[model samples]
Target: MKKSLNELKELAKICRGDIIKMTTVAKSGHPGGSMSSIDMYLSVFNLANIDPKNPYDYKRDRVVISHGHTSPGVYSALSRLGFLNPDEVIAGFRHSGSIFEGHITRGIPGIEWTTGNLGQGLSAGVGMALASKITGNNYHVFVLHSDGEAPKGQIAEARRTAKKENLNNLTVLVDYNDIQISGRARDVLYVDLFKEYESAGWNIIEVDGHDFEQLFNAIEEAKNYKLGPTVIIAKTIIGKGVSFMENRHEYHGAPLNDVEADKALKELGVENDIEKYKEMRKTLPLLRKKLEFDDYVITADAGTPITYTKEDKVDNRGAFGNAIADLAKINKGKIVAVDCDLKPSVKLGKFEKVSPETYVQIGIQEHNAATIAGAMSVCGVIPFFADFGVFGLDETFNQQRLNDINHTNLKTAVTHCGIDIGEDGKTHHEINYIGIVRSFFDTKLIVPADPNQTDRAVRYAASTLGNVVIAMGRSKIPVILDENGNPYFGETYEFEYGKMDILRKGEKLTILTHGSVAYKAVKVADKLKKEGINISVINVSAPLEFDASRISEYIDNSHIIIYEDHNKYNGLMVEFSKSVVENRLSPLSVENLGIDNYSPSGNNENLFKIFGLDEDSLYEKIKEKINK
Candidate 1:
């Protein structure tokens, strides 16, 4: 059943035709790169240890295409290898109702990680390779990337990690075709791939990618490499087969027309079948097979949710570190934390000390770390990617966005969120975590008010499935107190997703806040209580998912004041406003209070005062508005 050299060469020709036919029918896609990388695909699919029949085999090799725009090539090669139907792919490439999306998507039988954004695929492959080491599996991970994406900083980060971990099970095939969407890849951006890979301590294998023998031999040798990861820097043409298209940048993304397709098909000795696929595209099912996701979920022994008493003052991140450490201690391989050199800042010091192996220290590589954590999280490990909110969310937004699309079970915990991370200036202060996480439909955002809630939330996230972002501030704060001065999120409180904790109840107005500001809201409510200015304080831990129905009574009569340390135009205020209109609930008056502009570098207290986010500011603002 294995493909011989002659058979592979012939199959390669047919696959080239398939790629062209599919792209021509769709009137879009990267046929040039696909054609360039086709031999590598066939080589991996044929010579590699993978079963098309049992595509998701546990020990089967993972094929990750980093430059996913070459999806036409991937689909065609997989179809030839029996992973997908040839005709379906030809008609459905980038179709509105097809699984053959513009970029390669996971859950499509042969695809491992869904990738479109460059520089992430190598990290994803490194993650799978790391998992193999951790789980003691012999499976190898193969990532096919383009030379154009070699300049991505995250790829450099991934290279360092692959070397540091000594991941011999990982092999990368770079389609060094030298041409990109622009002119020559070197002209657009010069990346010395050989030097870089060698510097990263990678075993570099140079080969003519079009030669089946060289490709297969290189891949086999890469598998036999004992030192560390191998990079098969396949020197190739931009368009390998078609004479006119070869090394041409215009053909990179543009699909050939009918006349050009006819000429190309004739050159490859394949039939001009564009019209056939175009007709088939009309009758193809409105919806293809629904994506089969990785059903692996981590069930941690979510030990007793620790309750911080009113007397104990702690930062939410410190509590998170404690709780995550407890989880890592109890559950060995079931839980892991991916750190980007911010162990002390993110308070992952405890987890690292308790379970060192469980702590993945990929330094200063937030994009790669985010992606790697996402990959590992899907592979039966609950990976908590901890970092500053700015680095964790803002810098690595696209990586997280892909993770959302993949629907990975990742816990992205960020400290130094909002103006609370003062003196670091606007750059370090991540004031829009709520806004960023709101974009992720699958990811739930939790801004825990205090140490107790942080502990409970971390525990909850560990037990639960799907993506979650636990956003917190840097500064330490008092434990949020109930009406009787007892801890609000205390012994009896089970951290629920959408439910809000009413710290104190008042008749005149309600102040909605979370994270470091929740305890401050409690103080404001308590202050107002003495002067007969009874104001309610509600701690909205989960800003993304709020059951307005549960708090309808609080907002119906009381003037609602939204307070936080986030962008006023794009944070909890906007979410709450949308919720009010959607739920058709009426509050006396709605006012949004938060950072509308960037504050200067100083202590958080001064920053808060400058932004009018201090306890006194909220108290006075409430009095002035409600009294009117």
Candidate 2:
């Protein structure tokens, strides 16, 4: 039976009460947007074909809360729907150890995508809808936005793409509360969302966000129409239920004190009903279980195991493509791989050969490729995007950052990193890829030293959690470890994040490098041994958050020379220099050798020599610097 308008209003009131109590207890949260969007959230979740019990159900509709600052509202709805206990949900809001973080996280089961940053959810939702259409799945994607977030260009980009593609299964709900943190949204930035979205070819609907009946009717109407995507602009007050706080900008992110919580609960008619709420919390797990069983009926089994012979020598990018192709053999429909017109370059040709239906050639559109990957990740299909490091990081840095913000489990394989791309000239050489990617806190940058590590890293990244960027070099080096011959022992090489590997130990100077430069440093160290200079070489693959203790131990014993195939300003050299100074390790003279300025077009060897990165140049520079 469909819930009545009054009942939905009552649920929204209950949700607002919970939002106040939870944020107050946590002592921090966005209450204004939470209260304002409570009715819209209640209306959508109540009517959507989502199985709270089976949060991971394949066929269930997906909801992505783009305006993640309003996590209080999302948490409230999840709590009422039986996905979380009221107390646990309340306790975890902004708490250190709790999964109920300040923003929505993957730790919460029913939350489709973790989000905090605005303007990212719409792109992710578009990807999900696209994946469902491509895979022949009957699932709809719903994304909630803030009127204040309209200023971000990605949102407009996503809207245009959805319209062009005619993604009718996608629905976007804008919480037009007309207020940002500072003041009125109009004062901050005036955006006519209705006209903008309509002009972009979206079917637009405007309604009172607090009116549950009107919201439900619009959603139903959108579901019935199948021509293009729909945007439901929900006009609402900043803080709805709490009279003292309603429509106030100050309450946007302020936490209520004890007296305020009491007053808010009193207004909601649930002042002394803690016990009743606890009882309601106890029924949620069961409700979720029932919902899961009903909605997530279609199960895609793990497909056949892939067998590869050890005779073939494949590039890491090629190996990644091959592995994905193998995964497609089993679960063909559920997996989709997108490339930015660099399929042949990234070796996605293997996957394209086997499962052409699952491979999307986005045609050199790096931004579109990233947005598509974000969308595909949310739809439950593991999407791996491949492109050159310069294009992936330098070109689409914002898109990837948004992917991280949305917490989409998107796997990005960036190849042709560093000067190893060699003959392609300085334009194709990308040495600062690691530093740029490492800047994002939520992203994991995996630089595989060899093909075996690359294969393992790619496989693990595909199966693992959260957003990951796997970097691969252009040069084909030796296989450091044999995974096929000794799979168990090979796994022990241990890919613990932020850890460095000691390649060679010497007493004179520490040569810290990563990617292709590390291999060059190893060769240089071997040659320098003949000249009686024992230099230690460390392959610092995990550059973002390196194990300081391990690095300090190496630095304590020897003078440091950090070599990278990137610029010296913000690359590995700068980070190493900063780490040494910050940790106050043993006083050691540090010299950085890398591309000093903008590189000019030249052959790889000539460029390396010109940049003082060649083995001979490095040997002479180190010998001269060390002797002094």
Candidate 3:
């Protein structure tokens, strides 16, 4: 139910006081921007289809605040609207033990997405809007952002996407306060907010942000809009309501002093309850419980895992594409494919063909694509973002990091990893994927050893929850085989995450590898076997995680070598060293051969040979080490 105009005005005034007290009590936060956006926040949550009683209603319209620095304003608005206790937020605003964090978090009763990185909220909003399209839901997505963060290229990219997808159910409210952390937003960087979004074909509306009636009317119009997405350029004053703090950039991030707070309280006619909150703040603990994210259970048929024979010359990327297409067929409404214009290169062509409606082609916007896929993953649909490794991982690491924090169930199949995309040179090579994924606490990295493994891994990620990055190479290699020459990673084989697969066991030495080099490790093992030398070849597919107990047996009391088309210092070597030290496993000798430096343009075979990662190089190195 919409609050009466008179009630909203009274609440807005109180909310202004709430914002000031919360930030001042916290003694650190973006108070000026919070005051500027308080009225907008009040109007939206009050008028939108949200029930504080049933806050987790999946049908409730999502409210995403992009400029998370103004978290004080958001908490104030939410509390005043009865979603939370207004006094608790006022006292515990930035206190570490409080749910009211320094930045706006998602698990809060009314908040939808956690956003502080300027340009990502709109993309997330777009993702939620796209969710409505596929699921036959009519709920709208409202993204409240700041004009200071308007110049971000990702917003422009998302703007184009909103128009391209014809998302009429989306509305963006840009808090156009001229002042920013530097000075005026224009002086820092001129982003013609209306023109940029208008150029992208979004319907534009200019409004006095503090006016509840106008804000409500524009939002209502936006909801009823059928042409495309709408953007409300809300003209607001920095540090609004309080007379002294108006239009000042100094308070953009700072709270008011005691003297200033006293004077401000007098001007607003609101009680200065600082002493009461101070007592409460003193008693609060420093550590808060971890925030819980929305549970997103993805249900999908993994289709059937395919087994590539020794005669089948196929790249892991091709196998991934086939699996995605197959999953699309079996899981009709439950799956979506997010692509970044590298459909052919990333081998998403087959998936696109099989499920055109489920395939979302966001052109050349990796950051936006990452966030979009992350948001969509949580909102009923399982989104697979298929892209090249350089663009997917190296280019958009921060976006993926946010996805990790959001605990999104995103399956990112990144092809063209390592020097395997050899002719493209060092720029295209994603040698540090293991290092990148290692930084994440939740995301899993599976460097599938061959097409057969890739097929099963892709299906595994699709059926599972949480973030998964299936890293693959560009080159087509032969399928791996067992001692009897039967196909390894066969149809009967299930892709058990964190469990290492031992294909050929030997006692002379142990070779650890994954992705494109597992088959090469077998070649090295086979070569030594021909010379009557025994060794073990193990496939460590899930680099970020592995069954340490299983790997302890292979590396214990034996010479070990780690061969890969990855960075030597940060890849499996790091994980192996950690596990070995922790488990007290003893290795007679340890050798790691990987890309120490970027290789020049050449074929993958030549690049491998140049870097001493080729089968012959590994065979020779192991032979010398065993003799020693």
Candidate maximizing TM-score: 3
**Better model by lDDT, 2 or 3?**
3
Ranking by TM-score: 3, 1, 2
CA lDDT, every model vs. true structure: 0.89, 0.75, 0.89
What is the C-alpha lDDT profile of model 2 across 1-628, one tens digit per residue?
3467787777787888888877777678999999998887887787777766666777778888889889999989878876677777765566654567788875466676667867777877878788888767778889899999998877887887788678899999999999999999999999999889988999999999988879999999988778999999999999887799988999999988877878888987875444444343444432121112121212233233233334445566665666677767767666678877787888888888888877876665577678778768766577878889888887888788777765667788889887667677667777777678866878888876666556666666666677788888776564432213432214356456677777767776888887666667877777787887777888777677665466676788567887887777777765675676688777367788887776766666777898889989988878886787
Positional deviation of residue 357's Cα in model 3 after best superposition, in angstroms: 0.6
Mark the 10 consecutive residues where model 1 has the least summed lDDT.
290-299
Error of 1 at 600 (Å): 1.0
Q: Write the per-residue lDDT of candidate 1 for residues 468-499, one digit (tens) a residue.
A: 99999988888877787788788998998988
Q: Give candidate 1's whole-model lDDT.
A: 0.89
Flag regions of model 1 displaced more than 4 Å.
285-289
Residue 157 miss distance in model 3 (angstroms): 0.5
Candidate 3 residue spans exceeding 4 A from truth: 293-296
Worst 10 residues of 3 by lDDT: 291-300
